[model samples]
Target: MPQRIRKLIGTVLLLLLVVVWALSAMALAQGRVTELGWFLQLVCYVLLGALWIIPGGLLIRWMERPDQKV
Candidate 1:
């Protein structure tokens, strides 16, 4: 597939991923993280904040890939 197409798709997917991640994270925070002590809550928030980078990075890498030669 073309790089342009890959980027377009990846952009959409990345946005969707972020939305879903944020919603789920918020739910988790409201449900359980809020009940935890301050230090544990901080750790959970930090981990949840950074966890989305893994898939987002992969999608961005795919988006930036050189187009396959015919």
Candidate 2:
């Protein structure tokens, strides 16, 4: 992938992760975990954390390079 596209994908993934985290927090706070939504919410939380780790790290590294323009 081109550098620009890769950066865009990474940024999007990171933002999605953040949104997922927020939704998960809201669901938990609203006591949705004990309901039928628990399974989906659990999966979402897991994926959210995972997505943020690898892609977010790569994006940060890419953005940090002196030669690259975001």
Candidate 3:
């Protein structure tokens, strides 16, 4: 597969993941927000915000890889 294709696919998947992740996190936190303190809520949001980077970075790295010689 070409690098361009890989990058394009990765971009699409990453965007979908971000949207889903945000919605999922919000849904999960909706009922519990009142029970959790502000500090914990901030921590949860912060961690959720940053957690996607691991897979995104990995996909980007994969996109950046050179095609192997046949």
Candidate 4:
């Protein structure tokens, strides 16, 4: 596939990933994280906030990859 097309698809997927991740994180926070103590809650929030970066980074890498030569 062309790099431009790959990037366009990746961009849409990235947006969807972020939306889903945020919703899930919020659900978890509201349901379970709230029961934890303040420090643990903070830790959980921090981890959840940063966790999406892994997949997002991978997606971005794929999007930015040079097109394979024919």
TM-score of each model, in listed order: 0.97, 0.44, 0.84, 0.97
lDDT of 4 by residue, 1-70 (tens): 8899999999999999999999999999999889899999999999999999999999999999999998
Ranking by TM-score: 4, 1, 3, 2
* Candidate number that wins on lDDT, 2 or 4: 4
User: How would you encode candidate 3's per-residue C-alpha lDDT over 1-70 as one tens digit per residue?
Assistant: 9888998998998899889988987886786765898999888888878898898899889989998777
lDDT of 1: 0.97
Candidate 3 regions off by >4 Å?
Answer: none
Q: What is the C-alpha RMSD of each candidate to the true structure, in Å?
A: 0.6, 6.9, 1.3, 0.5
| Stretches of model 2 off by over 4 angstroms after superposition | 32-55, 58-70
Alpha-carbon deviation at 10 in model 3, angstroms: 0.9
TM-score, candidate number 1: 0.97
Candidate 4: segments with Cα more than 4 A from true spot: none
Over 1-70, each residue of candidate 2 has an lDDT whose tens digit, in order, gives 4666766776777798678867776676557544647678778567645655675677677755554456
Error of 2 at 51 (Å): 11
Which pairs, if any, clash in model 4?
none
